[model samples]
Target: MNLIKTAFCLIILICSSIPVWSQTTGKIVDTDRQPVEGATVVMQLPDSTYLGAAISAADGTFSLEPMADRYLLIVQHLFYQSQVVKGQTRDAGIIVLEPKEHSLAEVVVEGERPLVTVEQGKLSYDISAISKKHIVNNAYEAICKLPGVQDRSGKLSLIGAKDVTVILNGKASTLTQEQLIEMLKNTSASQVQTAEVMYNTPPEYHVRGAAINIVTAKAADNTLQSELSATYSNQYFGSYSGNVNFLLTKGKSSLNVSYNPGYSHIMTVMDLASMHQYDGQVYDITQRQKINTKGWKHNIYAEYGYQINEDNALSVGYNGALSGNGKGTIDVNGNFQNSHNDKVQDSWLHNVFARYSSGFGLDLGVDYTDYSMNDYNHLESELTGHTRQLLDYTSDQKIRKVSVYADQSHSLANDWTLKYGVRYDYTDNRNSQLFNQTEGKDNVDNSSSRLYEQIANLYAGFDKEFANGLYLSLSATGEYYSIGNYHKWSLYPQASLSYSPSEKHTFMLGVSSEKEYPTYWDMQTSTTYMNAYEEIQTIEGLRPANVYSVNANYLFLQKYMLSLFYERIDDYFTMEMYQAKDRLALVYRTQNWNYYQSFGMSANIPFSIGNWLSSQVNATVVNDRNRCDHFWDIPFDRNKWACMLSMQNHFSVGSQLGFDLDAMYRSSMISGISDTKPVFMVNVGAQWNFLKDKASLSLNCSDLFDTMRMKVKNRYAGQHIDLNMGQYSRTVSVKLVYRFGGSITKEKREVDSSRFGH
Candidate 1:
């Protein structure tokens, strides 16, 4: 308790010590005197302590507040050469940055490649530079090598972030999580130029929270290029995958297509124990199940683009996936159940965008998606030990949705910007289930629901640099949302203050608000069964969760970062196990929690060991608390502290060969009633490039120590449950990729992923 109090007091003191000074403003321009938007201006003291930083607005104007009159300023941009100037004037006047010629000869070659770079609070990794020394099979593999990125059971997450969204270029991904992972696995690293990480959600992106955008380079030659790859992996079973991608360019038009297919066989086991109380009675049940599944999955994507001019373009894309042939068996207290499942999804999108030299931008897009799934099960039970009871169940579900949106941005005088957008989405969902008993009448359950949502948002923001190395940005968004029968208007405000007291040190504080809505399944009122002992029934009318967050960040020499964050959630909705009747199974439902609170600290450190080895280490500690006695019908509050650590090491033998070692560990934490168990994993991989970079081979062993697993314990009210789930761990994989093209060169391309999504 004393330590916590001391830390709290220190934070308060730091925040309260921020000094206010007179504002200093200046304009940034290119060599030709044209206003340069997005150029970064950083102010630093003589000792290299960071004071503050700002980005030039559309009018190439920036303002800074520094306590001292004299300071050093550094200006940088991708298209311009970096510049430094020392000044003591409150107004530095016009500053010009020399334009950089995009030629290979002018590129600077460093002995050791930088894995990550921080600019304007965003982290970006250069894939091309990293791939020169490491073997990367796909975009996903490259992403795993990035600092502070974690892969948990095939899902990628960032440190200090509750949820993450992936965007292609600047658009939200149209594919689901599984589909996105598969797509990334099939895409070669050579096709991706850079991956940018944004912790603070920008106004242009409708979604809130952290996001990662993968940017791809355009084909330099006016010809066709293609790639083919094959991979094989062994877990408890064998899996095989293959992919083919093609890129074609002619004049101002281009087309890209990719297809991937995979087959896998898996074995799993589960043990569950439950204690339920109802009607003044208690029941204890134990069950063990073993299952085997064999399946195949396919992904197909195609995109077309036409550049009407330098500032106008049109894009269309189609993405689809299908998976089926799944079978499993379960035994519950000597009772047996068999099940099978299949799924299919398809999506299409079209977009048009235009930009003008007068700082005006417009984007319009529309998308449609359809998805369906089917599951069949059969059960046999013998309660009396004399008679055999047979039950058959089948369920079918389908969803169709349409979305349309338009957004525009306009630049104002005095380095201010305004963005506004409107979006419409409509979804129709249908679910049906049939239950049959040999000695009883058949029962059927069916439900059909439709939802229509409309949203309008407006945001205005400004970035100003001040004297005494202080920089600030203030922005707020007002959104009107109409979903089904619920309509409301909300304001999401944002404020940030940063100071660079010296050249190598920087401090920043930010506050923001956002909201999250319940998923379609979370709002469903249908009963779903998990084997014979458990069932789930979710109720409707769940409200969206509102979150207010505060964060403080410190960066040292652009290589080390430490962050402290806190968030408070109101009306949080999540799943919990409940038992309502006597002699009945436990049912899982989504209920509103009164409130949720969390505080966490994270650190990222990157260093080099010797001349050939480099490593990055990241650690985070968090305290989670929840209070919701009223909704649970009992006094239940949760508080727990969790910690996670991840380390990545890269060993380079030369430019053509590289090896990697990675390990991750996470401590248990409480989520609702479940107390999760600890998990740890280690991985090793190596890559070799031959045939003048046209052919590449990679070998990897995942979960080398076989210490990765999921276990959870839940106890609340009159229900107690323990579960240990299976995992696809300890996998050894090998991949070979080949590229064929003519006159290939990396050319930067500006493409917004939002152009296609559903």
Candidate 2:
């Protein structure tokens, strides 16, 4: 207890000793007396040394801390003339900017606008500038075009970072990854103002890792907006998806609604060859498996916001996802075994949230989520020198979660900003598996399990800016986790420093620590059969991992970026295949590793050829090592080197026609006891606009050469396996979009349900 008291006193002393500065306040408006939102406001010295920056809110009000008694204030907007003023501890009241007299065609040809800018602790991308040069249709597509961001399958991640959390309008989102991706797909690109990427997130964001914040344009008073779009794709089968969105603002109240529906049919095939040596016998087995599935999905969202006064606001929202009648069939053919299986699944997810914010830097929020899933499976198989076998089972899972948080920020004397927050989360999960028929020798049994978890977190941080164009931020979080009989307390500390001496060069360094928990389904004791010879099982006593990471980045010319990163994780876990020692069965399970480490470097280079073509290239090289001293009965240590390359090109003919070509390649890599082969893929797309820029048609083709198949080989003390996995990777898609309404904007809030489902 004495040590704790000493640490607390040290923190208080450090915070009180920092210097303070005076506050600068201002407002911006257009020539028509209408407020201008999303304007950039900056404070600097007479010699052009950067001090601080902020964005104008919906009411055209902004505040900044200026360490010096005298400074210059600069205001800039997209469609208006820049304005500058000299001030000292005073408010600049009602500054007006004149609209530029330029046509849309002329605006597209202006080459002076920069695509990206380096701010205090983030990299900001101008979405409007990028849209003018590319054929971007939605928020998801625009994010894919950002430098150093990679799109693997349908998921997005930074090139040299760990997990990424996406937020909207500076608010944390609680939706699952799949739900968030769908929402971004349905959102129109015109509503986005800027995208900010942060390597080490600040404490005010209420998140603990790297993040991407999407800032949307604010709506005009007393306006209504709506949009409709449809898509069709063919990849050995037909699929359809459509969305509708509406927004309304009147007086002090705003309402937003959106709906999306989709239907798909998919097919995949895999081949496996295994050499099993058990009980002094060696058996060679080969099998081919095919799976066909069809499903229907629907998503709905609604939100309402009320502004009680200039300094207070309230918002409430609901989001839901429903899918049912999903059916699948599997067929297997092998030299020693033959099997057929049928399965059906249904699921539902619901989330509700509310938030309240005050002008005095106080924010309070609450969220709740409920999720459920049901599955049924039946299998029939025949084995060589054995009788026919049958197996049937049903599984059900349910989860409920609740979260509450409060945050506060204070502006101190000089130029110090202090922030602190506290949050609590509780989760309850129930799972059951029942067997109806069993005809063959079985090692699995009917099981039921219930789990309860709780987490409490408290964090505080400070930010400071120096007169030499340098910025620094530091934060620390204490967390307590309780699950069943496991209880532990951990501390996570983060720090970042950035320097921008000039417009042509910027450098940043960051260090962070976090903890990652496994999925709920992976911890339950259960067995699932895929065929007569293969099965999957879940184990007990799985623990979360602790991750520590460091990264450094350099930007030159505002278009090229270089990054170096290193990371180490303790108690890492992943899935691996093992040969049963007493039988001719193969098992797949998730197990823990002692440690994992990696070091990597990446580069992003962008260029253009006149006004007709623009292109970007990305390359990364990484070395990974894994160690385990007690993995099953065979322990080993492995290391390997891997590399990746990708390029994206865009071609524009005039202002209404555009084309896009992209390609990616990945070298061979190793994971645990497996070695994967190389992969390559190419994609093409085209877009055309008509009807006074209100209608658009687009065509896209992916994996043109069908070269995305994956092959793996695993060889160890007594395990030998070769697997080939192929899916419907090649597809042709066409989309149509039409817009007719007032300017559109959307505000979204979500509940975290990532750990609620299988």
Candidate 3:
């Protein structure tokens, strides 16, 4: 009886001694009333040894369990100013944040590729921090060195994938893959803001194999600045390049302009050696050759911006480029045969864009692009002696688009919030082509078509975090798309869940569905290319493919991360062409009779041997198969897998000195007669900066270890026939730059990728 009395007395005493504490529950919402999920909330500690932190949910609600005492709370997110609340002693009070103004300037994400990995299916790369080091001569080379990316033709292969589309500010580019590569090759890296590698694209990106958004710099703030750069390279011959930029700002108005010009005289002599075996017998062959190509290009761009009000702004931009025709001749002396070929291509671009935005989370934009090109080809064989024929072709193309979008959010409960958004897009395109034969023959006109494409999207999502160190989110989306022969309405459902058992340990998994539409070339019968033999046909006009995919992504902490994806396509379209004529055909057609399933896995792992340096290896492997009418393997199917492995060295000298190096080993491949042959290739580079980081220099060497190889095999004729080619594949490049640009905002900010529709 006495012991019980003593226990009761002790409990009463402790309760009386404790101070009163208040618990609050509230939600965080943006100006548009949309919930701000994943925003970090921090409670400052008066004592030096402790800190408390929590993250918000998708619905925008958060809770504060009574603190020992209430202190200032700090809230922050990317593209938003930090928000603080005082006298908030352990009580839930609703908090709101204003969106920060943004410049189109590309954003630079930071982190050494060797030391970073996706821990929760979240993948990222920093462009801003990457340009600070002289890793390559220009942005062109720098992108080629991106982690998980392969350089088959330097521009065609991005992240080990092909048929990727590059965009500027979420808009389709006026330049083709080949032209884009040329422009960046002669441009400086200093102009780059950031490059994002969006591997697991959301639902909207299903139409593309990959997307690379190039974010350039916006006009300077209120300060005025200018920058200039020059580059010269001595390899196989020589080349020169120069660039100038100007910026001005007054109050809410800012303007920026850039001019770039380049000239090159590339002449090379090459001797290729190879050996072939047939029935235990060996034959040695050699190709002796010479080539010279020279040309010049100019790029110009100007942009003006005005802040209509605190929550509204207007901007306009114009871009144009003039380029000289490239002249090149290839001479080959192989075995007992001699050959020569002349090539020329003409190109130009004209583009204009405008946009308006309101602080209410509304955006309206319009864009126009005009593009034209011409090509001429001539060839001569010693056995025949004179020129046989000349092929001429020209194309004029135009594209225009307009878009309207709005978004909003609301708070539900403590650690919970809701988000919603809608978007409408309209695009129109037209293209025409002309073809001429050698002797003033009747010219042929390729087909031309004009059509408008419309797309709409809507989504609602919820997010919340738990006091037990757990977070969860659920979202649903509906999208509609319609185009020429391709039309589809799909309901894409996506969900994400995560758990943080502790600070150093976390786990996440997500699932989503997507639909891909046929490209213009795939959907039109006229866009395909054909050779001398009509038997070799390239078909066009394909249908949309519906894909249901489940993603399993995990990051085993800071040292390792991995993502596994499996997808089943309900209706996949593939282009099959007959091979009977020229090495490269210009006309092709398409058919849709095949369905396929593909499974892939990609990973990034980091390891360190002491403090000397750090390294990372990343690779992707996918297996997919379908049917084709051109080649006779089997009506059943043929399966192929592709893989890539890479090694990187960060900070060659030391940490503070800043340096980067990357080398890759991709698997050898064989795909009918058109697939490219694989060979070991390596690139090495170094750079330095002086004069208060205003002046920089960089040098790079490509294909220094081995020759770039491509062998296209022929499946016809009794003779073992194929075209094996090589040239002066090694190249050296250099770059120098000086900048005094408008006041670039130097703030730590974060971006919510989920802000875009699922």
Candidate 4:
């Protein structure tokens, strides 16, 4: 309690000590009298000395703090001519910009404009610059083209950052990563205006660590738009997916809806060899397994927004996903074990949310999510000495979550801003496991458990922009967590500082602290079987991990970046295969480690050749160390150094055809007691635009050399295991997209369901 009070007091004192300054405000409009959003407004001295800058809001309004009584105001936009005005008072009034004339003839441009810039202590990338040189069909593709951004197997992360949260229009979202990615796939690339990346997030966003905010273009009133797309992919099996997105705006109301449906057939194989030492005896085990899964999934989203007035607005939305008729089969054959299993599974998730915002910087919102999953499995196994065993079981799990939040922001004197918020979350989870048949002395039993968890959070922050191109932000959060008979309180503090001396150089530094909790099912006392020789079990009395991170970044010429980072996690938990001391079984269980530490450095460089080829190269080197003194009966310490390199190239042939090639390589790494071999992968894609740029066709091939396979070896304290894992990593896919009607823009919403399932 004393620490929390001291932190808050420090922030208040710092904010109150800054001297007040006069402000400059203005509005921008195009020749058609339409509000010009996303225009750059700069306040500068007569000799071009920079003072400050602001981006025009949705209503074309802007505000900036200027130190001088007389200054020069400049407004610039991409499709318009620049405007300059001499200002002496606080108000600059409305300014109009004329449209730039364009040639109708076909011509090829030989040079590219700068696409990256530093604004308001964040890295901003112009989507228009990318769209002019690359063929991007959706927002997700455009985001992938940004520097230092990486996409691995449908998951997105920023280079040198631990975790990334994605939001839309600078608003907080409750969606999980998977759901947010799906929604971005359905959004049209033309609707994206810009994307901002923040290393140290603000308190008003209600998210910690790094974040990516995607800003979309606003639609004109009384406009309707729609887009339809279909995709087909083939790996070892075949898959099909299709989606439709629609948007409508009239007067003061807007409606957006999207639907996506997919069917997939997936197959995977694994080979394992183990040498076990138990009871002063040595035993050798070898096994090969194959699995096949087929399923149909559907995703739906709908949102409605109403403008009650210029000062107040209301919005509501629903998001859901359902899986139907999912079936799978597993077959295993080994020297000491042979098993065959059949399984059925089904799952669904639904989320609903409503929010209200006022011009006074007050926001109120509520969200609810419900999720359920059911699984049934039957297995028959033959062990050593011709012993046979049979097992059948059914499992069901359900989760319900509710959250509410209120946020307020105040524009203080000078260029300072203060924001505060409070939020509460409640979750209920229920899980049951039933056994129908068991034979040959089963090692697992039927069980049921129910868990209730609650979290309350309070946060406050202050931000200031100095006249000399320096920016600073400080924030602190107090949290109270409760589960069953356990209760705890924690404090998290974050700080960030940035300085830009000129257009050619920018520097940033950030420090943050946060906590991550274990999943619901991982904390329960449950057991599951994979084969006769292997089983999965859960432990009780698990604690959440605390993470502390520091990051520093430098950007040069808006095209190159160098970053350094260090992270430490206490009580880190992970799943590891342990040799049972009392039996001949290999158990996979989640256990907490003493600590995990990592330090890394990364660099990104982008270049172009002859206006036809653009390429980006990224490289990272990291050292990881792990220590645990009381792990089962054997204690060990491990450390390793790893390196990663990736390159992306885009080639354009005329105005309609484009080609892309991307490749990545990772050196060997160690986790727990396992050491993994190196991995390399390459992907190629081609796109063609037709029908006056309204339709596009693309072809892509991933894992061109089929080298993305994992080979792991675990050899420690007289326990040895060799595992080779492979999946349908190589795939060939084709996609077709068509757009019609007027221009469209839509917002995205997410639910808090990342830990809802097993």
Candidate 5:
């Protein structure tokens, strides 16, 4: 009976699209015969639904996908006119889009609703500090409050996407967890404009999933602005920092200069543990370790752009940061194994890039990073009753690469276009660790090392549009793989289609393949560090993981909108136990040998209440399956489920005063790290204009509920401290901003000498 049912289902699928092949198929191009990148060609059906569509590629070329129903073809681009090829299925051939200058809108909303940027039916968010309200003294402490967002240490899960990538501007910012936070700590919210959070990237973006693009103020306004800021925060200790930014622009040429001076103090407490059996009673022992740390982070950036004759332009950009770290530790008991660990780390990076634009544009640049860390460990173990100190060594290294890429766009014909480009980056690194605490004659070197291929992604794509309101696009990306001693290559493919039958209805389907490497922290060997117990314990890194993603969605309703979407993944990466095996003292040894799979659904609904409030509700559910060959020692199960529900309310009372509120609730990881239950979180912020736009007051209460807490349990026992782990915190901030340079021709930007938090 099961085989019969399966056979019937297969027969139904084979017949579902049999009639679609009878439709006409052709390529779309512009007057120059160039393919327009992301240009959408759509075909409208009788039911007011877009049944088929395509996008143009680098060469201003596009392909038409056959549909099963009759429809009207439509084509459109960023600065182009909407071309409608109104007709029956017989007319579903070539879609030619014309270029139309569309820069007249005074205010461009960067949200994924398509108010700004090209809309190929994918969601996008721009992560910028320009317009974002900076909550004094915190970054992730603020970021976690974002809707459908959560951060555990350095890992950020956006809309429940564990394999997400956080990008600044348009490229990657490879800063460590703490460094990344420190960098954000100095950036003021006033410098941000909009952040586009995109779940599915179009063919043009050669990056990872769920991108947050922070867009700063651009030259479109022709205004010059600058500001300086400083901040002080008290948690474990009082910390202070400073930042300065100078921007200048006139017509199409712009120049920017900035420097950030970060001086800070930190103190943290940790707990450790071990287990023992006495008199048939199993007990866990504990230990405590304390560290008082001091550090400094310095950064510099200079960038300039010239319009050099309309058709040709150029830009030169450079940025770099240097940091110094030092720490001191103290032991309380005679057991030195539970004593303070002393250490220091110094790191710096610099990069330069020059971009040229002409008939075909080119991007040329290079970047270098230098990093090093050294530590001193003191051991006081009862087993040996020996007190000794050992000096450990970590030889961190780095190298930069010269990269060159080009983007070419040409006008193909009426509504058809094509576009393409490629980028290359070279990298080199050398890192190792050593300990000299034992006898000089025999010291163990537990660190494994290697040096090999460092390169940028080689990618390309093609797109096409149909005047019938139908569009289709194809993209191929070459991925980069680097590990301790292994290097491999993979091809990522992407295909998408958008169809709209009427002005207010749209549908989309897409599929793709991609890969992600474990961060240094995830792949690092057991890092020799003194825990609260003062013992030299190792925190091994999780190995690199791979993924395959698929998604489908639809949008409609002239005024009321409702859409549904789903995404599935394979071989997801996370941490799990191996063989459920262990010994006393946990002489720990584990590999990055964990795997899982997951699926999720998302829905968005928007409603208006009278003329005062604009509100929207979004809900999502994700289920993950842990498929490790053996769950063994792992305490958590292979199945996890998490759901998130959010509500966004925008208030409008005249124009001087406005507010935005977002609230969220989430369930445990369906296919996540461990077993965590549900929790509630909220974020509220408001912006008020005073003195007729001369001054503004922004108030924000992030983590309003302060319910953001994460907890983990340790399995072993130590001498002095117990391993009790979790992180919970909250922040409250308010800012008063006033504008100075107006009617007067803008001069070189002047950094605001003093501000509470930059």
Candidate 6:
């Protein structure tokens, strides 16, 4: 309690010392008086010093704070010529610009948007600008439209890097990567302003590897508001699900809550032909298997925020999920087995954050999470022609985690920034399994593990713009990590250089290094039997993987982007399946491989047809190579080529309706010993708004051709397995949303406790 009070007092002191500035407002429009949304408005002092910048809202209106009574204002938009207005006051009134094509160069095409831009080592995509040309339903879909983002086997990745993290509103969350992806899929992207991608994490971010930070727009024009939304989905395997969300905002306080309860039914079928060398003879085994599963899931989340002042704020959040028992039936080689399982998880977070205009920022946060899961399996089989057999298995697991961190940042002259932070994280996990044979003995296995970690990081760097439109950023992080009885310290370095040779082109080059840590469960020395023919295992003493990469990028007219990159990973973990005991069963395990390398190139282009239809396309090609071996002592080496092509289209029908079409295709790829087949998917959606634009209804159909399935072939010495997996890809969904508000308002952003929970 004393610590809390002390921290609160510190933040209050910082906030109280901040100097207040006078506010300003203005609007921008084209020569024809059409609103120029997404225009950059900047205020400059007499000495040409930057006061601040803001983006023109959808209505071409903007607000800023300036320290001087009279200043110079600059308005810039890609579609329009730059405008400079001097002697501007608090209310600058209306500023107009001529179309860019009217100038000598004719650089910018009408109705085209500069969707992607790189500044000071960060790549940012203006979501609102892109959404004008492409159809984006949710935040996840919006991210998928970025330059290098791809969905591979139902998982999101950036430029072939699978180890990526997400940050919301400059704060980390306590959800797993998969959970975060789900949440983003359900979240509407209309609330977001920009999506920033970082290939090499900076020291101030306090995270490793590639990351995507979602920056949300602060509401403008304060007014009480509420939004209610609901969605219904019909998935594959004859299952249906529904969800609802409600949000309320008034003044500086806002509340958001959601609930989702759904059921899942799925069936998997596989045909296998295996050959094993036993007793100087090769035996051929052929079998057909079918598995069916059904289960129910419930998830809930609530978050509330209040602004204590202009610079300080507090927030609290909760997330919980529960899954009911799932019944499974399997038919393998004329043998039958049955099983069931259930799980529950809960987490909470609280944060105290403060920001000062004097270039000092502080964040103090704490988070706690608890997870419990239990599964009971009963198997009945009759295949040997002797007698009916029965077996029982029970597994139980529990995990608890607590994390606290304090971070501070200070700004210096000449665009230099200094940051330092410390974090304490603790975790405890317990797992137990019991196996019994009806006619034989009983086997019991138990494992308990605990980890206490502390990390302290310091980052210092300078971002400077020199002559000839050249900008450079150099930053390095010194981090010390202590876990259990081991202690290590390392320095990560990052650098980037970019130059705009002309209005038509910008070039960039960067290099950085990052580390990838293993998940808590991935390092446990435990074994789990999934069924009569499959088992799961993990190796102990797993170490963090290290990555080093470099990239070069070129931007043509800000509407088209091209990039090339190379990445190398050491101590990489690969998942492999092997034949156990003469092809009787399969064992799945994760083991560290020698190394993995990839070289890739990507391109993103946006275009418009007339004024009612627009589209964006993205493509990538890569050469992937890996040196690894199967668990059954078989050497494996592979060098494969991969490619992905995606296109999104948006069409406007009159003034109250809109339609969208999206498609993506990927060539074959390799993961460990498994070679996956090619896959493609197409989706279409339509939205209608009514009730004075306060209510919206949207209908969507996914996987129109039903090709979003995973087909893989695993091969090793004297063993082969062909497998197929299906998910909820082929589905139809409808969403209804209603809002009651006078005007949208902005809320203060606070650094939360998400970074620690993970």
Candidate 5 lDDT trough over 10 residues, lowest sum: 749-758
In order, the Cα lDDT scores of the candidates are: 0.68, 0.81, 0.54, 0.81, 0.50, 0.66
Model 6 lDDT per residue over 1-758, tens place: 37435733654453344332234777787776655667888889878999777777644666665568879888998778898888656778888988876334766445545567766657789987665555565678788777778766557788746467777765654455556666676566665678988776655566656788888765432222334566667764666555455444444665555556666676666655555455666645555666677777666665667766768777776666666565666666633232222222233323333322222488776666667666666665553434454556665656666666667776677656566666665656555555554432234355545555555666666667766778877777777776567688878888878898786888888788776666666666766655445668776776667787888888898778888988888878766777766445577887787778899999888788777888888899999888765345776778899999998888987656889898999999987777888999998988886775556788988887778878778765666777665644577878776654311223223222222221
- lDDT of candidate 2 vs native? 0.81
> Which candidate, 1 or 6, would have the higher TM-score against the true structure?
6
Model 3 Cα lDDT, one tens digit per residue, 1-758: 37435733654454344332333345577786655655677766544223455555434555444455646667897756689776444555678887776455687443323223332223344443444333554567656545555556545464423345555544444455555676566445544555654433332322233456555544323344466778887666888988766555555776656667778777666554433334554445455667777888777666778898879988888776666587777676666336566767566666677767678645565555555445454544442233233334444445455555555656777968676767676766555545544332223346556667788888777777777656666667788888866677767777666666764555666665555655443344343121121112324445677666655655565347666766666666554333223221212234554566667787777665554455667887877555444333223345668776777665545432445566676564434323435556666776776654556677767777646655544232211234455556677777777765321321101111111100
TM agreement with the true structure for every prediction: 0.77, 0.86, 0.67, 0.86, 0.68, 0.79
Q: For model 4, name the residue pairs that clash.
A: 174-750, 174-751, 175-750, 175-751
Task: Give the Cα error of residue 571 in candidate 5, in Å.
Answer: 5.7
Clashes of each: 29, 6, 48, 4, 126, 4
Candidate 3 yields a Cα-based lDDT of 0.54
lDDT of 4 by residue, 1-758 (tens): 37435733653453344322234677788776656667888889988899877666444656666568889988998777899989988888889988766555665432335668877678898886676566566788888888778776678888766667787887765555776776677677767888999877776777777788898876544445567899899989998989877666555787777778888888888889989988998888899999888998888777889999989999999888888669999899989988998999998999999999999999999989999989889989998889998989988889999999999999999979998999999999998888898987446689888989999999999999998889999989999999888899999999999998887889999998887888888878888888788888887778888888898999998889999989888998888888897888999988889988889999989888976998889999999888878788888789999999999888998767999898999899888888989999998989998775567899989899888888888988887999888766799989998876423557767677666566
Query: In candidate 2, what are the lDDT values of residues 195-242, reduced to their tens digit?
Result: 998877776777766788998977644445567899998988898999
Tell me how far the alpha carbon of residue 206 in candidate 2 is from the true structure, in angstroms, after superposition. Answer: 3.1
Top-down TM-score ranking: 2, 4, 6, 1, 5, 3
**Candidate 1 structure quality by residue, lDDT tens digits, 332-384:** 55332232222222322222222212224788777766666666666655443
- The TM-score obtained by model 1 is 0.77
Pick by lDDT: 4 or 5, better one: 4
lDDT (10s digit) by residue, model 5, range 540-658:
44344555566665555532333333444443444431111222232333333345566777766666676567666778877767654433444333665677788767676665677
Select the stronger candidate by lDDT from 3 and 5: 3
